[model samples]
Target: MNKGLFVMALEVSNLNKRNVYLMYLIIFLQGFVFYGPVAVIYRQRRGLAVSSIFIIESISWILMIILEIPWGYFADRFGYKKTLVISNILFFISKIVFYKAHSFNMFLLERILMAFSLSGISGCDIALLYSSINEKESEKVFGRYSALSNAGLFLASIISSILVKYSLDSTALLTSVFYGIASILTFFLTEVEVKNKNRINIKLCIDFVKSSKNIILLIFAVSLINEVVQAVAVFLYQIKLINCGFNIVYFGLLTAFLQLVRISSAKTHVLSSKFGQNKSLMIFFIIITLSCLAFLTLKNIPIIIIALALMCSSSAMISPIILDIENKSISIQDRATVLSIYAMCGDILSSAVNVVIGKVSDISIEASFTFCIIICFFALILLCLNFKGQFFNKYS
Candidate 1:
């Protein structure tokens, strides 16, 4: 047997098992971030001002955006497993750094590490998973892939309810410990061999992507909705809860509920099979638009919780569908690179939305949600455009 083909030939069963199981386990472990509920409080306790923290986050986003394509290229050129191993190591190191960080600069260092780690993992992990599984199983695998992370996050948020009241440092330490396990798990992942390992031609790739923008538009549109829902959930929901006189201590419980709703991502394949992809996604964006609208106007807690659940469900359900579409639209040779570019476009827009949301949030939470409404409208429009042309008859 050729040395390069040994894993594929002799270890077919093991390769199939390790790639899927390890990725799921790694993602779940990575989600055990005990500091998730108290990230802001932890930073404030460490003496960083809100402005400085936002600045650091923005810088990290920028760095991640800048490195996204390059990291993807590296995964394509070198190997996916190597990239994931290096990325997981950096991710664990970043967690450890966060555990020890006290000053603004120290926290900034952790973000810097994260930008590199996350950028590398973005396209490579999916590319690896997509390669390992039969095409028919993509939906179930991707669905479970998404749900398990929420499961980890849900469990972590529950633990955070107690851990936060006791010790923030311990919270950071335990989070890092889970991340440490994630790093080790990456070592067990089997790399699916790339069909084309030749050096990428930059200009040719650019022209090719330009020609394929329609299929790409699907993820871009979904990204807009996902980012808006995510920003609202992470940044502003707490304020809304507090304004309604909800106690801060139960925030972890509230967060757990949100994560619980996100578990609906695993059911999206069923929804897509029932309604078809276009209808299911259209329904999601419509739910998002209405959710944002209700969140803006309603004072009723039950109504608000229902709206948030719809938004979370919409956001989670769209991801796997978009990913399936994206993977089908690309050739195996350039899959990781194209996916990274797609993700980069989404990140760029996310940064813009975050800026819009942050600025408008300072003015009023209502204004921020209003901006999300406008974004959802555009996303809904783009989602329709994705399936309209003759091009998608080929990819769709």
Candidate 2:
């Protein structure tokens, strides 16, 4: 096999699976800690305007967008381990600040710090995982990583529900403690070497942008649509469940259940290779559209649960497929930066959509769901047009 082709092959043994698994565990714990407070922020701070909460989130995302590529480049040069350690320490500090925050401004400050820390860590972990594997197997390796991370998030959601029910402040403190643990565990991670130690030149960024324009555009569009759908679901589901007389605990449980379904569905790689990424994505989009439509009509707990599961599962399925395609198209050296750009686009769009959706929810929950359906439909059309050719060819 050609050297480049040989490196592209993804085998499980080639990766430091144990370290990846540990990273996944720490991330899962981090999610559980972070989200426990976030899941109830709107409810806890109900006195504050919903617009205020959205603005804070939007600001955080904007900060993340600005920081992502710089941090990715830093990782590419300094080593992934160093970046991970710094990110975890920053995360720990941010959690402390969040725990002590007494006002909205304080919270926003902590949020900004958190966003910066998260940006520093975002693509670096994936880059490390990719380095551990052969280049060809990057997609499959990333798929497994995605699945594990989702599973962590899912588990964290469940724990968050339990902690939030008892005491939000305590939950915040506990989450901070978990971050400390994650930071400690970071020391155990093995460092990966960058073959080229040259400073990240402007040309590399330009080259990545030029070469991966189509994939980048598709990723941005899909990410924005996905975020809108998610934001709407977040706002709509809360109101819908409340209207249906479900308690907060039950709502959290339902959310956790959906995450579990998503994590499980994400692990399966057969769809991407067998049906092809583009076709698989289209099918998943259809499922999401149907699920959202069902949500508009379904009121019963059982039916709503089923619909939410389908929506979550389908969304989760689409991510790995899209990411696999994205990973396949980029060179190893540019992978983190390219992925950071992709993430930045998604975060910016999602933040904007959240603000809009929050305002729309205040006016009418039904209208918000209607908006989501429209967005998903448009996304479906884009996927169809962009992916008309075989999955890999569209980007290649």
Candidate 3:
């Protein structure tokens, strides 16, 4: 009995390492069901106009923005495991709604549900992984997580493409099944112990902002750039491709190709090591801006694909790096709440921009791309401000 107990303790001590791999698996499942390849096309097939689709997506962003900080506070008070489980379950239910819905109102309902699910998961997942892993191994674990997630998307793009070829309803059904499995997987996750489970409110957020105002601003700026590009890519890029004279069959393949680019770019820390973090971040931001410019001007499929590859690569490269920065910038106890605040600011921007993009797209997809180019420049300006000395060094 003593020997068995000793061995059990030994295993529990090493659980963080195991959790890293488990997180990778969980993130991969999420990517698989993200349904990126067929999302926009599926809405169009369901008879939703592009403008209406954006309105629905905007509503999702609005809900997410509203709930993000509160959900994070709840996770901090209650526990990460329960919040994550609820997120998966809510997502599964949303997928079911999506599968059965033939009307825009039904899809709107699904988006609302999905927004709540996303709000719960956004900060909690990263906070859980950070709390579980050794601080030294964070960058490596995050890189692996991002890579595996993209690989899952790579597979999902193909699977969703094939399933969508059969029917949009079929794609939704399969996505729900994936989420169901993911929900079951959450039950197996080891919970991170929290010492302070007291209820925290908006003051916690205000304190964080006061301490790390610059970093928070920088994080929000980058997040806005990332979410806008992501929203457009997932929901409207297919339309851009269609305008470029590509067939629907190639959408999945193209999306799969972007995932590969993202996977390859996931190791931005390596770039940071080679060329200091500031310089490396600047380079990637410049790449993103240039890619947007290319998309603005280029009409050929090959050129557009190249531009998309650059955009995805930069977005993937910067995500974990920025999270690593934010993780270091704030207190561990307040991590999830602060991070949610960061994301909520971006979603607020996303909600507003989604409507504009949708409306502009009604006139011309090219004009929409032009709008994206302008947004990228705004992000670049913010990035430049942060790179100045002591700019993000307020609390750090």
Candidate 4:
């Protein structure tokens, strides 16, 4: 390469680092409103039943699945930066609604708003970041991004623990402020120029499907791992803590602990290199399987904590590896749409399964955990089949 060309590339790399830093800041500010600790507790305090809460969450995922592609199309056609700003605005509005909500119906409305906002965010954010840097750096970049986002959650967890002790409403109010700040930060995001700026249409969709079908299949195969761990198990673990006679005030602290574990685990390459990505994924699946068993068989706090650590570690490990595969396999112009399709797999599963999980939890928490164990076993089998067939060879 010419010296001048090399210098220009170096300058662009430096600029990309700056943009990534801005993204980190936005992620951190949004983390200040950490709702994970308060999510179930907040609904219970508002007089909604557990099943009702799960139904609301399921509805949210349903909306996410419905709106994901459209919002992804918007990001591709309009602008990732503008779409992100709109998403932040929607998040702010949702938080305000959540703060003012007194009835189940009111909370449902808030979740609907939230789903749309998150739909706009999930695909576009990753697409923007991946586009900003060299393709080879995407996995490393996502690892750093996940770590910083976890750090934000860790800090927020401390405040959330204290705030929830005071009032759930207070947490909601502060969360809204965080979203407002994050929205402002989005204005500073550097937009990547797309070479093929085509409008979304049937032909485009068909092309995406044809090109990404294999990766999409693999994505669906691993989707259960994510849904079972993050969407289902974590919430149940909170209920488990409450059942074990722990005070609600400690929920935020517990959430923070998991975030710490995730922070440690987000550095993907070391583990992937050591075990190989395929074997590493197998290890994570086995760990999750074991954790599900622990929840079913153990009641001691120490055992519960160990199980949660495994869950968190596996959750962190799987995301970047899978994301790198999905993101790198697609074209820049179609990145958001393809990634949305990937997310839609997980959302579809979570939406369908949460209601059943909720009802089972209502009947028996152990039964719910048992149900998860069965799903994990099935997921493990699917993963094995994929690997044995060399499904991920192309990505590797």
Q: How does each model score on TM-score? A: 0.92, 0.86, 0.93, 0.92
Q: How many pairs of residues collide in each model?
A: 0, 8, 0, 0
Q: Write the per-residue lDDT of candidate 2 for residues 296-361, one digit (tens) a residue.
A: 777886777687777777777776666667667666466677667777767777777767766776
Instruction: For each candidate in turn, give its C-alpha RMSD to the true structure in angstroms.
Output: 3.0, 4.4, 2.6, 2.6
lDDT of each: 0.83, 0.70, 0.79, 0.79
> What ordering of candidates by lDDT runs from best to worst?
1, 4, 3, 2
Best by lDDT: 1
Per-residue lDDT tens digits for candidate 3, residues 1-396, read 999999987787678656667777888887785356877777777888888988888889889988998898888888888889999899889889988877899999999999999999998988889988878767767777788889888888877777766776776787788778888888888887754678666686767766765675577568657855775567656777787789987787888888888896567678767887677778877887787777777788898788788878877878777778778777646678887887887788778877888888888877887887777777777777777635435556
Q: Candidate 4 — which residues are off by over 4 angstroms?
A: 1-14, 210-213, 231-233, 391-396
Measure candidate 1: CA RMSD: 3.0
Q: List the residue pairs that clash in candidate 3.
A: none
| Model 4's TM-score against the true structure | 0.92
**1-396: candidate 1 lDDT, tens digit per residue:** 588697666578677778899999999888788887767768878997645665676777788789988998888888899999999999999999999999999999999999999999998999999988888889878988998998898999999888877787988999999999899989888777776677765555556677777866776787788878876666666667667776767777777887899999999899999998888888888998998898889878778878887888788888888889878877547778887888887788777666666666667778878888999899988878886863556667
Clashes of 3: 0
Residue 298 lDDT in candidate 1: 84
* Candidate closer to the true structure by lDDT (higher is better), 2 or 3: 3
Model 1, stretches more than 4 Å misplaced? Answer: 1-10, 47-54, 390-396
